[model samples]
Target chain A: MKVPCAIVGSGNIGTDLMYKLRRSPVLDLVLVAGIDPASDGLRRARGLGIEATVRGIEPILEDPASYPIVFEATSAWVHRQNAPRLEEAGARVVDLTPAKLGPLVVPPVNLDVHLGAPNVNLITCGGQATVPIVAAVARVAPVPYAEIVSTVASRSAGPGTRQNIDEFTKTTSSALAEVGGADTGKAIMILNPAEPPILMRNTVFCALGEGYDADAVAGSIVAMVDEVAAYVPGYRLKADPVFERDTYTTPGGTVPARVVVLLEVEGAGDYFPPYAGNLDIMTASAVRVGESLARELWRAAGLSERDGARDGARDGARA
Target chain B: MSASGKTGEGGRPAFRLTDSTLRDGSHAVAHRFTREQVRTVVAALDRAGVPVIEVTHGDGLGGSSFNYGFSATDEMELVREAVATATRAKIAVLMLPGIGVKEDINRVAEVGATVARIATHCTEADISEQHIKLAKSLGMEAVGFLMMAHMIEPGRLLEQARLMESYGADCVYVVDSAGAMTIDDARRRVAALRAGLSIQVGLHAHNNLSLAVANSLAALEEGADQLDGCTTGLGAGAGNCPTELLVAVCAKSGIETGIDPLRMMDAAEEAVRPIRPDQGVIDRDAIVLGYAGVYGSFLLHSKRAAERYGVDAKDILLELGRRKMVGGQEDMIIDVALELARERAG
Candidate 1:
């Protein structure tokens, strides 16, 4: 059985998510809605035989049974207002905005923990790329603080992202602590304007507890990269983990024994250019979450293990 | 005598002054500006009536790392001390969006930094909107800086400046980070920005071609509303436009900077010059780097790479220029130098 999903906000991110769902096994994309009927995204979705609307969430509310899951891809401000209404309609929400009214989820790190949540916030793209690594380090040794700097091509950021800059930083930073298990977290984003746009590059600085073994931390981080790569095929480490012994004395105070990891995420060319690893990670991770949630609903609806295996065999045979 | 006093070439536009001695000068000291040095220099600049003083790693905020030379003292500590020392001047920081984040800006603001100059490449002003908006929301005076302004033409520069203005930059700067722009280049870009943008226009010049002061004058003639200078011309790659020289020139030309030239000279000669590794002068290396349109910040990295690989720094810089490498690609310096050394050996 396929769980029905609808995408609101037919912009770059929402449209991209629609394209990705075309290949999903369990989630059926039924509607692509936006504020602009003339938007290219809505036009494209209509051409693809998906129900496209400009009326926004009211239609989804009128026919809530058609969409069991709604992907909220609007700006953070819009999401803050729409989230409660969607919950009242009894539809699970996958928020792409930084409004973050729901529990934050990074597929590789904590998707299962928040699978039952009514709304799951994907956090920022930077959070998706770096949080798992932070979690891996936290598992090995105590991480007092973690900081990540995400650099992406300027051309990739849309106006909505440009407007919600504060929410982006605040949500990404808080998720590092709340989801990655870091004591404290800070996030920075850079938009590179090079002629040939650069790939998404991230620098993660984790302040490890004194006496933590460098090898163990590196080992755990490398393993975590592999797991994230299972969903985000473009995820990889730019270089081996570098250990630095230094005292960083800020006006706030001093931080000691820092371990730095440099990461680069090359996009899979799903709906954006290969350099748009920031967008790719979000869509890819959302698919993983959506599939898992669809499976859970199927099980809760009395679909047995044999039935799941039968569905898988039928899909395999059809392919 | 008002802090907001405006005086320019024809007594029309009132220009503001920002001092970069402690910030950009950190490059000359190998990023090792002591807390005491920051305290003393900021105090002197403040007394000299400079309106704004930028404080951060020479490359910008969050630049203290192994790749970029580590700062001798923490930048936030330097920021706090600079803030405490200044009485009239508003403390500012140079933040390249990728290098520093909102948290860093908030931390500096908490310590009393009231201004943020968000910088981007000339064509990439759109990237600065988020950061600039954040700065304005935090109640800081936000400025947009377009680095390597010589790389593009006036019409395009105006478009980028307009984008920044829409994003809430109080002012926009055409940065000759390589000190490569001639007087005409400065005039054309500043004129375009003045004509097209409703917001204020500014200029940041280097002295690699010994044209920092002259280029700055030309920009002011084109109605540039703000200018940057470093004490004793202390900054990256032949340093910045000398603050004392700019003040003296403005005075003689009947333009007002609201700063006393004599007092600025005392600060430059007594407080700044003593600690300088070298005065800002157009040496052969700086000339070549500027001639090739390479970034001013790349000089130290190229020099270090040349030393490590036993290659000529001049050849490395020229090759980097030919490759059209921009800032943040410092890793390529050593790679290019190594190739040059291999070719020489062959």
Candidate 2:
């Protein structure tokens, strides 16, 4: 009963997603596609006994109906080119690039809203990490301005991330508004080169409108952290959300009150090292979204819950 | 200009001086540079025969944010004013790869900025490749700026410089961002870059340790083709090497910078000094910044946070240094202050 899926782009993010997809219960990874024949990610997939191709999206295009879902982990430029073709072929895309081809999705925030969309953009890793917190605060009161700073180890950022740094900032900042529910959003990323590379860390600053209860806001943030942690086990607050008044200065004006939240994300060590939580959160969130889509596809086909359970049992026996 | 200190066809040791009074000085003033201020500074520098004048937010393009202080005037407006005022000088803008996106560079270029200085931390030069290439493709002079050069050795810095050279940089700079380098430190880094990079080498020194002038001289001896200075040393932390002082020294050392030293001094005294109350002096806090090897722009932010939270700014600086915080981590100033306040209260 597992929905068959394919992954395109054999880079750090694609390779990492490959490892996560293998453990997914509702989705089966059928193919990994890349342009470079000698790419380490493609070679690693072959060694894992999974089907991998150097033809990029050609293999998936040949038999598009088989892949109900295709995860695009390539660069934003490449995703822009592949997105329309993948959609015409009738495969739902979970885009991990900064290419904002469809509605942005943060699993805990708006996954259910975009389940029926042909494609869903995960924004950038920074957006995935900080948007939920902004949504949490916004749920209590309107956020006038929200700014996030994401610091990751230099070693964890491949050449793709380095070259597309502009797109990363723009997409993440826009998501802070479009997904995180802020009037204005600013994003900054830092590549830390400290020896013994540091875990991915984020600082989210939100400027709130008038008459919001601080206690209610703090409670909302705490609850949201728990929900995100349910999928991303290593996602946790480095410090409690620090509330202050009249500290943040936005383009509109100086805000009356603000809250600061610090977060550290440690990877699941699926493919990259533990410090590469930037990549981990994207793949983890993708898996969460892909599973939801698979469940919906099953329901659309009039499949019963018992069928899923029986299929799981059979797969377990085989293992 | 040659790395061997050879005299050019003009019959004197060739050297270039870039004035950064409008850009780095924004940090000392908390990033509140008015358009009039920018125009005045640019006019003064241009009149004094400065070949390059850099103008941007203190942290670079797109730096006006909640973390970094906001500019009083939009940076593009200020750049326009500088461009309109300067006749002899080519205008430059600083763009940190992560903080400032390509759109910011495009905007600056559209506003007539001819030079783009793409900056990164000393060890993170890989991030500057795209921006450097973009600048070059835009037909602008691209310079790779490596900040916090004192944190890494000369050999490692040269490796980073090599990365920038491979990215098509017109020149590479050994920037003592913390102002912690001594004469030897400056000499060795400039020498390494000059020896390793086929492109030109530049030096950007600060006066935190009161060695800005001496270090600039050492860099000159190592054949640094370009050097940055500010009018009256009006820049971040203890300010930068004073443009007037650097020109005077270069003249005394038999170097031809094509700048009028007396006009530069007059600009500092009449145009620059009156706008700011204090000269960029080597104060205790600034010295602590150098001693701790913290980013120079953190000075005012740390001081304000420490004062607001009722903690020691020096202690905050030392902790930031211990954590190896680089530039663009200005938000951590308030975080460190809050942590210290909680510790004291508990």
Q: Choose the strongest candidate by lDDT.
A: 2
Query: Compared with the true structure, what per-residue lDDT tens digits does model 1 show for residues B31-113?
Result: 89999999999989888889899999987887775445668888999999998899999999998765566678888889999
Model 1: CAPRI class: incorrect
What DockQ does each prediction reach against the true complex?
0.19, 0.61
lDDT of 2 by residue, B1-346 (tens): 3544633346543767889999999898888888888888888889989999999999999998878877878999999999999999999999998899998898999999999999999998988988999899999999999999999999999999999999999999999999999899999999999889899999999999999999998888898889999999999989999999998987887778888889999889988998786977688889988898999999988998898889999989888888888889887787788888989999
Tens-digit per-residue lDDT, A183-238, candidate 2: 98999999888878889989998887678899999999999999989888899987
Give the Å error, residue B271, model 2: 1.9
Model 1 TM-score (2 dp): 0.84
The best candidate in terms of TM-score: 2
What clash count goes with each model?
Answer: 2, 0
Best by DockQ: 2
